[model samples]
Target: MGNAVISSDKWHPVLDRCLTISGEEEEEAFQLLENLASFMLPYEISASPLLQQMWYIIDNTKYDGNDKRLKALSVLTELSMGSADKMQLLIDSNKNARQVLALLLCRGKFDVRQQVLVILRNMLINLPSSIPFLVERQTVIGVSDLLTVMHPDTVILALEAMKAILENGGSPMTPENNEPSFSLLAEEASVHSRLDFLVSSPNEHVALLAMEILHEYIDPNDDDIILPDDLIDLTLHPLS
Candidate 1:
């Protein structure tokens, strides 16, 4: 670890060299830097510099040459270790993080998207009051786009986030309706398309969750379903 720490400043050179090599040499450079990052995890100073280099390498890879996306993500958590500012950096650095997360829902392989999703979910979960207002301003715009692209995994994770919104409950600015609309039944909710997208997922876990909610809407024995006697009270009256 100590040796790796000394070499941390030299990471940009190593990453640059790694990009030039082919076959085993290239692979070795990748492994070396990866291992170096792992060893530096205990030290914040070392990790931050190394991560900045990784992000730079990854960003540069966009113009020409080989793959660096995976590596950027590999050390993403380490880069942002306990930093509240990490989310903002992701949003700023990666313009497509949101779009790709939506696109990658129907398509997987981008594990970075999942890590990014975790960050987004945490943001929503931590700031419940602020999120609905955020949602109103299009926080959930990605969910609709992901569905159109048939990205079920992204959709499912997003729905889990949306369910929190539903649990907390808010209404979008609609043409009419004075009351707050939890009414996924209403035209404003976009419920049917949302329903169709999730229900079609081949992943059993995804499909099962979709079915659970679908049942809530169309349950034959309506009496078999349960509703909080005070759902409105729970969601509507937000205490200061």
Candidate 2:
């Protein structure tokens, strides 16, 4: 295919055009964008005026219902983290982007949200021990639920996210925000509490999921990870 001349002044039209295109053409469009992600291709799509317009459009739209825009956000997220400048663009736009991310998280769009969770957690995990903005400051349920579900790839991502919070949990949390800290007991208690709710669940998957999270983390291969006393007691004494 010939070059799909990227816009210089406005991406909204091109963005809309992409959505209107047939599946093949749209995939081609996405390839063009994703290709820009490679350092070798090097057209600097992030600086494009058209790309800026697309970002602005995504910020204002009801993307929960927009598959095309969701597709684009997933792609852009991957590219924007390739460098400090790009990563900062993502961080700077956190307010505008965070809402959409939260929606994806709440809605459980794992195909996209799972990847994003991994990316975000990995990025923030070792960055001098603090979150970048208000978006990061809020208590998040996404990780907790994922832990309960034992989402295969996501369990590790959730644990990575909680790592910092757990470390910081040593001090008494203000009454309203009683998040568990890294103390092995607190962490185990938090996991156990979530699991307790699932034990009576009709969904065998749910019980099994809880088992996975607990068993894997408390495995002999694992070190210093606590298993809540109740969970251990339950494990040691299964009621037939």
Candidate 3:
């Protein structure tokens, strides 16, 4: 069915139905959209409208955070992370992935949020072009908020996103014409202070990621940069 010769015109009704779907119909509608994504990717159909519908379906809140909505979003997230071509199309169409990300980051249930994070991490890891779009979307604030959460997994996801931005020269310090405009937001959010507390996180990955970011971005002479003894010891004595 993914190979069907469906024109872009045909997808409009599907989007309309998805936007207005309810109850069991919602799940089937999402599944159909997911199936159509294969064809959509190969053709030049506008993906943003479909993405917008998915966001609405998820945001209705009338759904009361049901599994059906999550299922649809999971598929949408997967589609966003599908490939550079697909993601580029979404970007070109000016589809904002950040709204969907914000919903998952701020309010999604634990498992759903984790899935969203995985999708985000993969998107950043694979698509460097997405950095400006994300940074412009003020994603750093959301990533910083994740650091305050008690869950180490979420913290790791946040770290990975930051790392991607930093490594890709998406940092505030990056010298480029199109740098994201809200560099001050990171400082205002006190992201460094939150990361300082995570330096000694019980999770090794979390601790390491925190240290890596601090090492690169935070001034070594700054009074606020506190290194955990374990992290210091591990750094001083490698292979121990």
Candidate 4:
């Protein structure tokens, strides 16, 4: 289905239905959009009105119930996956895109927040330009809080996203090195403390990832760093 030669015009009806959908029809409309998004080319999706409609559904709080918002986020995640242009279009088309995503990260349900993290991670990976926008206070704090979630997958996603942000944003230049860094984000008390706590997580993969981020970005001079036995074993043997 991904290679099916569907004209751009074919998306119009679906876009129209999604744009005007309401009440009970909202779920069906989003479901249809999600299916279309899965196989649609990034350029085709960007050229159509689909992104705007999805943003409308996502930004409007009235669509929060009936799982409509989650569906919208799912569609977005699929659309933004491997295309830097699509990710850029989503950010450029909506001035408040970052804020809306931050709100979802902070207030949405577990699934919803997980979808948002996926979208942010995709953005950080595909579109380096999104770093400055996504690295702001609310977004950073929201991602930082996810480290404490009970779910390891969600925590891993958040950690990976933070790692990408730090890698791309880079730290400020010091006397030792001339290159800038994203240390400001890593240095945030909330984010730094969370990494410190996560370094000892029972999940060895989680602890290793957290430790890698700290080792690369964080100042090593901090006090009270505790290394767990699992981390020691994993560090020596490493995850295969």
TM-scores for every predicted model: 0.46, 0.56, 0.67, 0.78
Instruction: Write model 2 residue lDDT over 1-240, tens digit each, in one string.
Output: 223433233334545576467577777766655554433122445455434544653454554455555556655556444554555555454444555554555464555566556545644453323242312222245555565654644654555554444434443223224533334433443655664465455644455445445455434354434444454321211000
lDDT of 2: 0.48
**Clash list (residue pairs), candidate 4:** 170-181, 170-182, 171-180, 171-181, 171-182, 172-181
lDDT of 1 at 205: 54
Ranking by TM-score: 4, 3, 2, 1
Top candidate (lDDT): 4
**Weakest ten-residue segment in model 1 by summed lDDT:** 231-240
TM-score winner: 4
Off by over 4 Å in 4: 2-5, 19-28, 170-182, 220-240
Our tally of clashes for model 4 stands at: 6
lDDT of 3 by residue, 1-240 (tens): 633444445556766876566778877767777766645653444533666566666666765567756766666565665667776654454354556565666567766666666666666777777766655334566677778888876787777776676667544334235534343455666777877888878888788778877777655576656655565332211000
lDDT of model 1 at residue 43?
Answer: 47
* Prediction-by-prediction clash tally: 2, 2, 0, 6
Q: Evaluate residue 179 in candidate 1 and report its C-alpha lDDT on the 0 to 100 scale.
A: 38
Residue lDDT tens for model 4, 1-240: 444534447556766776566776877767767777766666777677777877888888777754767778888887666456666776777877777897888888878888888888778766777776655555676888898899997898888888878777553222123423455644662788888788889987888888877876675455544444555442211010
